[model samples]
Target: MSMTEAQTTTRKQALGSPLDRADGRLKIQGLATYAIEKSLENMAYAVVVQSTIPHGRIRSMNIERARQSPGILAVYNHHSGLIIHPAKTFGQGGAAAQAFLPLQDDKVLWNGQHIALVVAETLEQATEAAALIETEYEQQAAIVHPDNPDARPETVDALTIEWGDAVPALAQAEVQIGGVYTTPREYNSPIEPHGCIAHWQDGSLTLWEPSQWVGGARQVVSEWMAIDREKVRVISPYVGGGFGCKGGIQPHSALACVAARELKRPVKLALTRPQTFTAFGGRPRTHQQLALGASRDGTLQSIVHDSWNETALNDVHKEPCNAVTPLMYASPNFLSHHKLIHLNTVNPSWMRAPGENPSAFALEVAMDELAWALKMDPLALRLKNYAEQDPQAKIPWSSRQLREAYQQGADAFGWSKRPLEPRSLREGRQLIGWGMASGTYPVRRTPGEAQIVLYADGRLEVQSSGVDIGTGTYTILAQTAADVLLVAPESITVLLGDTLLPRAPVAGGSQLANLLTGAVHKTALALRDMLITLAVSTEKSPLWQQSPAALALADGFLWLSDKPNLRVSFSELLRLSGNDKLIAHQDTFATTASEDDRNKADSTSSMMVPPTEGGVSAHSWSAIFVEVAVDEDFGTVRVKRMVGAFDSGRIYNPKLTESQWIGGMVMGIGQALLEEGAIDDRDGRITNANLADYLVAVNADIPELTTIDVGKPDYLATVLGGKAVGELGIVGVAAAISNAVWHATGKRIRDLPITQDKLL
Candidate 1:
């Protein structure tokens, strides 16, 4: 059932209205439970010792000295008790990013690999013991950088897309522009570091961890321990933050479980800030050579994006650098290539907006260069080449308002008052400029389940294994149930982050609000059906002779569809039917991308039921405008203002979605002016891992941030007419900021974190 068609009562607000988060009070009052905060009897703490050498084999390790230290319980190196079988979660949509299991062998793939696990009576003792343990390695000459002499190109097939020939077409075009754009490695670095608590009870292993994929962890852990799937339980009731670091299982989680079982006590482990940068994984640095050939009129003719990213020797994960390259603009000929260069670096994992983030950084800035070459306004150039449909997929959009976003965002940003020449706008020793960029992200909807129960006391309960990751999942799910059952949002209780609840998809990809809410919708439909059947069979129910099809439920009451006054409370209906409550469960599974065209049910565009719409590509679009003030003397760039407009199908909560976009835009400012993960070239160690050295945009750094929502609903995308919204806002943000810097200084720096040194 579409939320657009949902029946409501006096509290009719839902789906689009702003509702306070249901868990807000619990969090503020410190009553909310986190994995690391959980207490159990005889609990121990563990700290991991990381490998210092980039590439080498452990000659030997001596843990005796550390084991005899104060409060020390046990210490395990490759030579000790830490033993486990290899994991099996691989292939399509697997959970594990780094295949090198912790403490499985003496081989060191990179610096910061887990070399040992030290357990003690307390966290302080464990930390001290971990530092005291001795390790020696037979270090080998290693290639630490992807551009090293020994680096070899490994083609990634999934990222390579071919259409018409791009090289020759570029040679014949009227206006051509291209350059090599580089972005440095960056960390996820959530406010609360990744941690987990593992325990074993009656042969069943349970884990309380901050993980996005609870089900995936259970599946992987079960295989690693050779235990039955039902014997492994992963619960994560609350997570502080998860950009992409928490999307999959980390090596520490597995190690914690192994140590807990061997010691027969609960073990807790948490990564330090520095450990998170190295052991947990970060965004890989990328270099792309791009070329854009356009007509004198600024119509794109040929486009090419060829790129390489840093990958480790043992693990192979591609960034899909060309994910946003092929279809954004109306290019007739385009070529996209992704190549991997193996280095002695730790395996990199997904950060937020993994593929599209870096892709848009290069693509959008290159578009600005092409516009300059054609002597055209940047926004005008983009308007001249707006794609009416998917250039590569040849499919119409499910719902798109990108044009409105561009126009509205431009109007709000005062694009009409801007001058084309660089260094033209000046204010008291500060040079000012304005720029814009377009953004896009595929709407990725995964399958999930929800369990709903209607009580005899006229209250409702909903349960799921889904996590929030600070995106307000608890609030939206409550609103969905309230709308479906026509009950006050406060009267419904929502339970999540427990494996015991109905299984749900990971909270990444910004799909939780769509998929989990759909699960709740489906469960509600089943429950309504059961209640209607019971009401008709009760004989004393209002209009007992009425058809089930003609009976409509509203505001916790049953009545004939046409007779608003003829009604019986749900509690009364339950009493007559001799049941205390009603329970319903549903699992939502998405069909193939093309399945929507063959059968409408294949769209499954919602969380509750099969889709009734068909034949379109579902995507969210965004546009951003940035104004920067660059100090002429010091070359310091400060963003003065920003305006963004988004078309993400339907708005679930305006305040939440607006905050999401603004947060992304702020991160974009950091990407353009302040953030980079610097790796030391001498020994392949990560430098500046601490927050003091790494710069993120603070509240003082931002001025005016305006947002506009294109509120048109999309029935074809989902029942709520909503597409994925979380990652869309950051897609083209860095590019827009950098473009503004170019307009201010007439100096275009293709590399990221456009620093003072580059600006001067």
Candidate 2:
């Protein structure tokens, strides 16, 4: 529990400098252990048996062949020894992507539903035994698509928004545009497909899973298993990637524990790449209809966004497709409807930038169409509709710099030199065009706890169960601690990815950094205050004569505020006090601003109001500019380059922030040019489940990327002045690329994956 005395330093890392990950050496040396790579004394492997039929009852069960297979210990069906509890939503503070439990009955709700599990001594045996299991089903007609005559889609009241009538206002506008845009279902496609290792002993269960929220996982796994919360332990030390797919505990995670407990052995379940498509979750396919009405001067008069998304047979999770419509633009009369259509498909769930990614393709393209009707520049149209305050929240914005982002982006991308008409600009044997779109994702914050310990030797340790899904959690926290403690990065050690550590919010929704920093900020300040108190508490020390109120911390010393040279180092003071280490723990609640800042400055968004009035709306904004080249004869579109100017509150580490932006652009390129999850209507199976059949972008597809930040810190979002950049770069990327393709070829493809056929 104590660091060595030789392991401390008093130098600090530069705030804007990039820091390499602390685990880089461990990973490169093959010493890092993933969930599937952990070895135990005796471990069993499990493979799930999926339902062949979309909807119906299992008429006859046939598990004799699988039960008799070599090394097969058990083949469990609904009537087997396995007992499971139905899914329940965690509380507001708890993290869960969805609440649909599996394997509770013999009725098949959808194809690829996990109906049975085969546990064996080896992975080969488990896989072979799973393939041998077969069942007879009473086939029933399935609802494959929402367009079916009998299909009924229900509008979600909570998701739908209405204000002044949008119907009449649309009819009265001088310029109007109506169009339908469709985005295909997509997979999470993290390199590390979901894998779990479950062990149970003495009525307690332990799971090593790559979950985004270990605390939430413990809560759910405990509840579903009828056990105490403390009895369940979850560990996710280093996640390969989440992208919202592994944000919570999936049903397979529980199944592994169930099988492990039943067989009295550790169970390991690893999903194959094919199973990754339908085993857990994927982004729902969307059909978005937009009607944009604008004045002759290109100001929005009205806007309505109607969406119908695919859902599973009984799953009621709603994709917030209309979420962006309420916050993005200025429209007096707005109507947004989100309807869920029942389909015989796997349960659809969140992907990166879930609603905003696909929704932007529809709304931004409609805005472009309105711009053409009004004969206005696209960027000019966006500036005309800039919202000073949140449209739906009706609250003052904490911080907004979208206008500056647009101006900076346009200047960098050479917007003034581009031809206004599509197909008017050309290169040798190719047509060149430029286009742009605005992007935004809300700045979300959550409550968290951090534990800090400062030793007599001057070393520090910070602990939290924060999962690092390759978003630089380790490096950023080290930088934060170094900056706060006035110590070198080597002196600060961050311990996370364990359930026993302090609980942290899930690492999705772009919230972890903002929320984690708040906790760290509060905890470090508490440690500093405690040190000041300890240094002046008694008359035995030099600082005992000085008041604690007049002390300032610099280089691990508490000195008089007015006299820089009069100081006593913490090490010497602690040595004299006969204490080895100082400990402090703090839980922070996210507020609009720091107490000092709130008490001092007046808050303003659209109107000036008292700073402490209420919480504020926070959003990270970007203006994406893209250039594309279309082969005139072949009808192929290629992105030549991309430039994005973002106005996220503060840049914690500019290098990591730029890396995240480039990765998001690559993901957007995949969405615009290639990436689609195909389904077979005949049997409801995911077609092209494997990578060989389903394509993603490779190194050859990546284009030159340029990411620049406005570089202004806004304290309103958080006292640290940092906004989330995780999902900010992913939104609006597809729309920007698609808009550029239209500008190059003079053909607008509303459907996603603007493929070669769509180009022609």
Candidate 3:
């Protein structure tokens, strides 16, 4: 059955219910069109040739043989004079993941940099031609890792947070615990891989790509092509999965656009799996040193955290691993700073929770160690140090239920029955243990517009330029409108991920649902008001002469709240008013993009306005509990179960929220026991560039999972009351798993992916 048909058959209520995804049917039936699937007339195929050396300058290129090959249309190199301008980096409020444009110069900044693009009549021809091209490079010695002696670490002043003298406080503390933690580079291996098709016609350009930020992608292409923004259109209705890889405009996109414009024919380019590892940014390798000082009674005295993560030499994108330190706990003295280490690798981008994931691992592990030293339960230690307010921002929490989350998760996980000492619980040859950790992510919302239309035929349409990224954005939009209009969800149609729709922020930072829903809510309310006005003005309608306040809508009918007999169907009201549909548009949570606010820029024609500032700090909190079993001889560790209690503030869909949390927990399992991107130091190339070499959690790796919502409405944060939920699930997951391993073996594994070798 179709998604709408299924919902109608089941008679499911909208909003906060376990409603199936609105796009589930289309996806399963292969009817959903993703980027690169959009077929065009006379479309040509393009393939990329990458640099072999870590860093160098192209000396010579031999493209004669490839050009002579059958079906080859064109081969573009740095000398091709491809007319594409440079764009600001995503960090600088532009769409590009990195500032340095590829195939623009002879200089090679990193291994696997796109050196050339070959276009052909067919995919096979393009692939063959791309492989036939050869080049010589003048190689240079490269610093490939943060640990390299020649690598210099530059501290980011904006990331530094300091209040009191933490060093002195640590020295005078009654007890202190500290540790160094490291996480290897990680790749965002989305199932569909990144690809794009660029088509130009009638002085306008259209791009079909799996972009997490459709509006931002359009804006970037317009700036790079030096054309009017109106001349560029980005259509990305479905994305297999983004996880930050497709969050920004990558080089291949620009390459495809340039090739299409130059050749005057549509060009399609899809990166191979290995190319994905280098073509786009991934999570940077992080090195963190975290220290905590506390009193004998487990009261936190000081917190000091210093961290460095790898960034490309061509672009600076530091992984601020110290970001969560100050907000994690209340301390009399605090010091946290972040530094970027230049490496001959691709510029790193946000992966999942980005800063919060790695930072939470270090901080939570240190908290576990401190708990061991204080002879207190890890959960107890966390509860003792929980900040009632945002310690760093010096503001009250808009809404915080972390304490409730802890209590609820602990009760659900049966924490009271667990033995305190390591290796105390065993089952046959397996050593059993329990561990817990806390997680938090900031609540960020950007201004966006939503357009809603109530058709006289009793169907509703909600439109926005937002991408779902598989986070149930479609369902959220449908549910929000259905609830507001008092109509069945199946009667609503939602359009998104198109530049033709109303403007919206990029679907990143866990902000899309909150931002989009708020706009939809505002529009829905306005639409209801319009319907009421239509009914009250029509002399033939029973609702005539009634105040809007006295009118109520339910079951697709407008009626007086006091007298149910006096009612008018929406269609009847529309017909009486001689209108086919009622349309409403609203902008919500708007922000003006200053230099400081560029990260949240919205490039639509709507004059950028200031967001209503609130004094309270907003964040989503969670408490994760894990149970694990360790093999005695084989050093195999298995996560048996996990329970996560979260306070994300007004979950719009409980079913989808649970799915997001479970998926995040699975990723967390991978982070703790499997996933890592291995880079070859000699060439700065990722040794494990494909799924065969790289490891991630699969069905066999997942354990029993549970999620609890301890959220409440926080009107101060957003009118919808929902906070960010996408990245919150993975925040403390790795830490909880690592701590469970420690409890099982009494061996503290400081590094990530606690492999069997590390345990052995």
Candidate 4:
């Protein structure tokens, strides 16, 4: 049925008590077995030997002395196994990984490259032995910045969206603004580090990993080992958090698998917190030039964004740093181009809103500048240029509430009280300012599969391979199933984090709920149909030959449309069916893309769910207003208060949804004023590799925050009618904070983290 038809169906009041997450008790009690907590018989510990020099060649490896050290079982390097092959160079763009295969080759292209791995009986012994191994290397000069004259240009990935002659339009425009904005490198520092436990049993490998994408990890592991994909089983029942860092398979997993095979025992490898900076992955630094031309009345005439980013020597990674600029406003002429420059740094990977986050920083900041130049209100200017249709794709949005978001956010934030001039408001040596930004993330959905089982004991079980990653997936899935099955959530068991289960999509792109929940709802509907068919076919049943469509399942009982009193309990029906359990599976595929769509040609946009109100094609929208107090003397910016309004579709649980927003705001605050990855240009080493030196948003840095969920039901997206809200909460936050900083200090800080040094 079309989404409109689905919406026409009366909204049913949620049945049963508010559904509690089935795994909440286990998680709170620390009974949940995360990858690092798993224990196997005869498990050994492995420690990685990493490269100290950022750019160099390993002349010789002297491991004899360390091999003979106490508690060392085996030391493996590139030449250990004939079957171990180096990682193949994949086609460029964003598909590249950060740290390439360990022990794959001898040359160290980037600092912290894994050169050797030591396996020992104890974690301490393995670590101590790893430190003992020595190596000699020939250092090479490296280029870590795009502005460097010696930097070589490479084509990592390129995306071109052209509409009109931007150069000529800019030449004819009445006003123009040009500036370069740079975003520093940063790491996604989840509470739990990337880790895994691998065991090789008769050539098949089993691994317990903390990952967001289980199937992706399985694919990478299989490819790394040259083993059949089915031979690799990856399980991640509970991940502390990934934040896009744990989406792909890293070197440590492969290292553990190889170590286990050589030692004939389960091997566990967890990167030290400092090691994670290099061992895992980080967001690449972006250098971009924005040229915008507009009319005297603030109408966009032309916009051209050219960006260059760095990738590793072995792989190419590109961030569409200008992705949001073209579509963010109504512009007649626009061009966005990206180039990759090879650096002696680890390959960068996706972080939250990898492309748009940095892009928004530049675009929104530039918009603020343009507003100031035009002596116009930033919100007014944005409203004037807002696109009713997506200018990039030339399609109407499934549903866009951006104008409503701005109006509500401004009303709630008391925007009328703010002074127009920057640095005009101050109290007690502090400059106070308020800033806001519009946030948008494209709706994304993909094919997903789920299985549901109904037991005779009045319990339901939902199975999918989707990992939760701490976003309340378990609770939402259970709630969706319970709402449909008319069963209590506590009585329903949700099973996930196994590849052998029904094929589910990866838990990235904020699309998990839109993708997987539809399959769950569809499966529940099918299960209800089966139960009705069974009751109707039974000779002893109340409505022996009733049509299935004339009956409805509610309150754990089946009743005819005309006779509510005549009903049979689900448990009773199950007993009559003479079966202990009944199972059904569902797979929901994406709608075919039209031939005229250019996004279809690109892999990133191929699987994107088309614009729909509810059937797995919903987008979440939010507006973040930030209040900043800047100390002009010390160049310190403190977030005093934050208020956000989100249209996340229907919130499954108000408490969890609110918490997600708060968490996202906290993370956004970090991205705005604290998080940065420091690199030593002399040797291309990550100087502040540990958490102590690399700053994050601490409790003291956080301020009073309020999250308001405008729980508008999206009728076009999914069975639940909820859009992907996880990433939207963070998408435009940095810009809001940065804009606030600009308002407070009267200084346009183009760089990220708005550091004190930059302010000074």
Provide TM-scores for the models. 0.94, 0.93, 0.95, 0.92
Clashes of 2: 2
Per-residue lDDT for 1-760 in model 2, tens only? 1121212333325345677767777788988687778788799999988887778888878999999999999888887857767545432223444455666677887778888899999999999989887899998888877777767988888788988889899999888899999988888798888989999999999999987778778777876788987798888888888788887678888789899989889999998888888786688889989999988888888988899888877765567778677778999999989998988777787788877777777888888777777878899899899999988878888888898889888898898887878888899989997889888887766556788888888778888887788888777777776666665665678888888888676787787787677778678888888888888884566778688888877566767777756767888878877889888887664355464332111110111122223567878888899999999888888889999989888888788888888888888899888899887878788889988878888898888899989847868876688886988888888888888888888898899888988877
lDDT agreement with native, every candidate: 0.82, 0.79, 0.87, 0.77
Q: Roughly what TM-score does model 4 have, to 2 decimal places?
A: 0.92
> Mind giving the per-residue lDDT tens digits that candidate 1 earns over 1-760?
3222446342456556788777889999999998899999999999989998888899989888898999998998887756676664233335665677888889998888888999999999999988887888999888888768888989888778878888888889999999999989878778889889999888899999987768767866776777886898898888888888888788888889899898899999988888887786678888999999988888898998899888778787677789788767888898988999888887888888888888998999999998888779999998898988877777787877999999999999989998988889999899998889999877776666788888787778888888888888888887887767766677778888877888776677677788877788788778888888888888877757678898877667788877767878888887777789888987665544343321111112223221212567777899999999999999999999999999987888788888788878878888888889888776788888789887888889888999899847777777667887888888898999999999999999899999999988
User: After superposing candidate 1, which stretches have Cα over 4 Å from the reference?
Assistant: 1-11, 89-93, 539-552, 559-566, 590-615
- Encode model 3's per-residue lDDT on 521-602: one tens digit a residue: 8898899888888888888888888898888776678888788778788888888888898889887743444532432445
Displacement of the residue 454 alpha carbon in candidate 3, Å: 2.3
What are the clashing pairs of model 3? none
Q: In model 2, where do residues sit more than 4 Å from their true spots?
A: 1-14, 90-98, 538-544, 549-575, 590-615
**Weakest lDDT window of 10 consecutive positions for candidate 4:** 596-605
User: CA lDDT of 26 in candidate 3?
Assistant: 95
Report the Cα lDDT for residue 552, model 3: 78
1-760 per-residue lDDT for model 4 (tens digits)? 3222322331232322234555778889989889889978998998988888977688888888778888999988766762454442223212114337677667788888888899889999889888888899998877766666777766433476678889899889888987998888988989899889999999999999987767666766776778886898989899898888877667777788878887789999989988888885678888889988999999999998888777777676667787678767899898878888878877787788777788888888888888888888888989989887777767666566777788777888887787779998897889998888877666667666799988888678899888899887887777677667665555568888887777665677788877777888899888988889988987777867998888876556787878877778778887876878889887675454342231222112234454443433245777788899998678789999988888877677676677778887888899899888888877777889988999989999999988776656666655566776777778778889988988998888888888899888
Query: In lDDT terms, which candidate is top?
Result: 3
The clash numbers for all candidates, in the given order, read 4, 2, 0, 11
Best by TM-score: 3
Q: Give the TM-score of candidate 3.
A: 0.95
Which should have the higher lDDT, number 3 or number 4?
3
